[model samples]
Target: MRAVRLSVVTAAATAAALAAVTGCTEKSDASGGDDRVVKVTATDSKCEVSKTKFPAGHIQIDVENKGSKVTEVYLLFPDDRIVTERENIGPGTKQKVTAEVKEGDYRIACKPGMKGKGIRQDVTATGSGKVAKRDPRLDAAVASYREYAQEQADETLPKAKVFAQAVKDGDIEAAKKAYADSRIGWERTEPVAESFGDIDPKVDLREDGLEEGQDLEKDWTGWHRLERSLWQDKKLTDRDSELADQLITDLTDWQKRVGKAEITPTSMANGAKELLDEVATGKVTGEEERYSHTDLVDFKANVEGAEKSYELLKPVASENDAALTKELDTQFAALNTLLDKYREDKTSYVFTSYDKVGKADRKELSDAVNALAEPLSKLAAAVVK
Candidate 1:
């Protein structure tokens, strides 16, 4: 009887110990597990998100496009600053974007057409790290650039109005002049301007993106479309005037929207290099202004835009590495000098005379742009360091 009692007591004590160990294992697993995954589906006009609450840390989202339209999923802050994004998701497909976020509120916006104010879903993240502190210098630089964008935006409105009025009145020569002149402001701020939903594409998309079976008579608009009417078709129709009015309205809206934009040093440097690339790919090849042959005007304007971006970030880059800054300055000056030879005046360049330019001259100009682009590429890294 004594042996039986002892055996039963021992068995009960072992069972209790095992239960305590199991409870601790469960607690540890809960504390250090995988990040919460959010599933999202995008349709024509709506965004459906699986989860609206998360624990702050590294989060992953699998965005499936269940719609007919091409879409982009963006994780934006309250101010519309993109935290991370997955772009160019085609129909019947899926892509993913992962970001390490602190405890705060975030917005998940899905742009179906890749243009327009998209459907947004709000999420609340709970964690120890909340709203990470930003570098003051970087913040100041972004603010300065935002102010510059506003100035450019204000500059574009009146000029764009004049250009539209010329098209409305059927004054071809005046309209052409205004078109080239007005584009300067738009080109200067193109990088930031492009973030403003549907308006940017309407204001500046190239002809290569036109839909299948879509043509001038069916679904073309904006600067390139007008460029075709004025130069290729040789007549600015009533439709052209209507499109012009729409462009003006869009630009006004863009001006307001850009006020909420966020800028970073990396983006600014990348914008500079991107403008040079535009010169190389389109302007140099004469593909951009196929109808008007106004490639030189755009080339000059692209250089101006690139120069502005480079100048804005030059201080930070120079502090990091003066040698790189010096090299970039020299390369930029060389490119500018080449562009100056084609200028007709302070605000204009001879777009028609591009055909007359010899092969050697074009090669020299192209080489100078390429030279600038190389050193300019490193500026972004320097600014980050």
Candidate 2:
């Protein structure tokens, strides 16, 4: 009886020791011992681990969300496989997830919050049970943004031609009104305008002279020359006709220079859809804490596209399409105001945690973006029609 009691006590003590080491009751079968703990810290800059490579074994990943918002940690396998996902980890919270990793490469990504930014790190398994570190996904995200910028450039040019024709047909007022209506689709392209450089000069806005209260010299700048021309006196001469013809030729040349700045609503929708898809797939990783300077470019492109489109469609609205013209005019005015705000708050409209922004400021910024989309969408649909 004494020998049996001693045996039971020894077994119980061993089990307790194992639980203390593993942080769980289950014993690891991979290494025949529970000894490895992979610690990952998710902070402002990255998802970093003390070691980058790990050996094949039963491993415990202890993730610490040190950022301002909730974060999720995902372990990804080579075949686009997600070995495991842990979610809803609040700021400063720590959670431990265990996985049986074989001899292979794996990725670790942490998404801070819904619609928030994400970061990633790579880990390699070695023979001696060490982890290798790599963060290639960061570069991958930047490459993706550049590709998107090129795609936007490809879609803007043809649309500019239709816009110039509207101006040449002695329909400056109609053009002005239509330009206002096409803001949404144009705004998306605005973020990439600088990439195209001096393309707006191809659209000629100088054929008409300034009218009362509308000074082209005061208001006109590059692509915005069209808007400035709108308030000019409605008179045409032989010289003006020649100028208009020249303007059309210039616009065609500009379109060729800029490529296509006009991306259809369908295409814009598709791009947005792709962005959302990447976000959902845990594939969207980049530094977006700052307002994507690209957003400003998109804003400008949209303005340019709208200005050109308006030049083309203004006549239709003024003659046979009065109702459509009036609706477009109203939408464009609101959009112009929105663009003004964007220009003013270009650097301020960034994506950071609520904690990083003052309460009133955050609300105001969020409201501005939210307000613009619906009105912009309405305008885009009208212009496309």
Ten residues in a row with the worst lDDT in model 1? 15-24
Residue 139 C-alpha lDDT in model 1: 61
Candidate 2 has a TM-score of 0.27
Q: Which stretches of candidate 1 lie over 4 Å from their true place?
A: 1-134, 213-218, 345-352
Give one digit per residue, the lDDT tens place, for model 1 in 253-354: 768766765455555665566567556644687766677777777777677767777787777779988999999989988888778777766555555457
TM-score of every candidate relative to the true structure: 0.66, 0.27
lDDT of 2 by residue, 92-178 (tens): 877766554556687777776522324777887555553223134322432444445454434434444444556667676555444
Pairs with backbone N, CA or C atoms under 3 Å apart (clashes), candidate 1? none
Candidate 1: residue 328 Cα off by (Å): 1.0
Cα error, candidate 2, residue 118 (Å):
38
